[model samples]
Target: PGGVGRQLLQKPTPAPAQHPPVRYPLTGEPRILFWAQNFSVVQGSKWVDLTSQTFGAEASVDVSGSSWSSNDSRLVLKYANVLGSPLTATFHMTSRWFPVSGRDWFQLNRLELATPSARPTVFNASQVTAPSNYSWHCAHLSSLPGFGAGLRGHGPSPSWGVLLQDVQVPAGTPGFSPGSGRGSGREGLGGVLAGACLDEPFPPP
Candidate 1:
């Protein structure tokens, strides 16, 4: 009986070894996030010109028609990785068009950016930052037979421009490696044009 009790008391058979938790790597690639605010059109203004510039590339959109003003619209553009060494990525733009009427009008949706070689990137309204009052002017083309654009001409007063910010994805972000070609499962940025409410006074008062 004493021997049995001693065996029961012997150190409880030593607990299993505890190991440290594993840590995943983060993707340090540079990304640019930008959006527009205070976007409104005056009566008789048939079209507005929007431009986004970054990483030595520029994207311009001429927004026209009353339907665009009535509902939320999204625009996405994709370009070859400007940061890449050989510079072999192609350039393209994609626009997501939604219905102007009904429930779709109230919901804010995400935009996607895709490339031929990699997966798509998604951007949502939640990611947008506070608005800044950059002067965004409409361009007037003489061939179009309209008022002169504002940034260059004394045309209509300039409107607020888009806000641009640099952001980085956490380690282990998918589709970041050159030719990794795997989906990150997380939303990413792409060429898109969308209409949604922004933080008040995005262009600033």
Candidate 2:
């Protein structure tokens, strides 16, 4: 008599642990448009002037893309040699959410200057010499505003610098040369130099 073979029941392997998506500080090739009525950069012990001559003068920097979440409150930008130095300059953005306004307002909290010889030298907002009238904005390729409209605004300016995340210039716009990392020789009034585009990834904090 042939013995009946019993079916072996094997336990199913548990599904891989589901993890939340990772969030970065920035995403897409966004251009950071910034301007200030008056500002300065600390060079050694003294402060170097980097201001705009006119009230509405501005500069921009095109950055590479990163994977991020919409809930992130921090954005970091890294540019190599854009400051005419071998080290890379990192801009750290800090934001606060306003439920009443249903928007997030951010500011340039600090600037990090990377050095080949040692760790980055941290520069706070005050150290950057940004005057009380300093203003800033951010633009993305997917959500660029009309030409010259990104910086146009009405009413009194905010006390803190605002990073307009949804403003940008098209690839072939005048005065903006993609992939060149250089401006159209139109430096801001106070030597606020334009930054070159760099494909660097800066993760969110």
**Candidate with maximal TM-score:** 2
Q: List the candidates' TM-scores in order.
A: 0.23, 0.32
Q: Model 1 over residues 1-205: C-alpha lDDT tens digits?
A: 9999999888766632222111121123322112221121221334322223222133322111101122332322333333231111111112223445221112223333333544433323223222121111111111111322211212232221112211111111122221011232112212111222122211111
> What ranges in model 1 sit over 4 Å off?
1-69, 80-108, 127-198, 202-205
Q: List the candidate 2 regions with Cα displacement exceeding 4 Å.
A: 1-31, 35-42, 45-62, 65-85, 126-205
Clashes (N, CA, C under 3 Å) per candidate: 25, 5
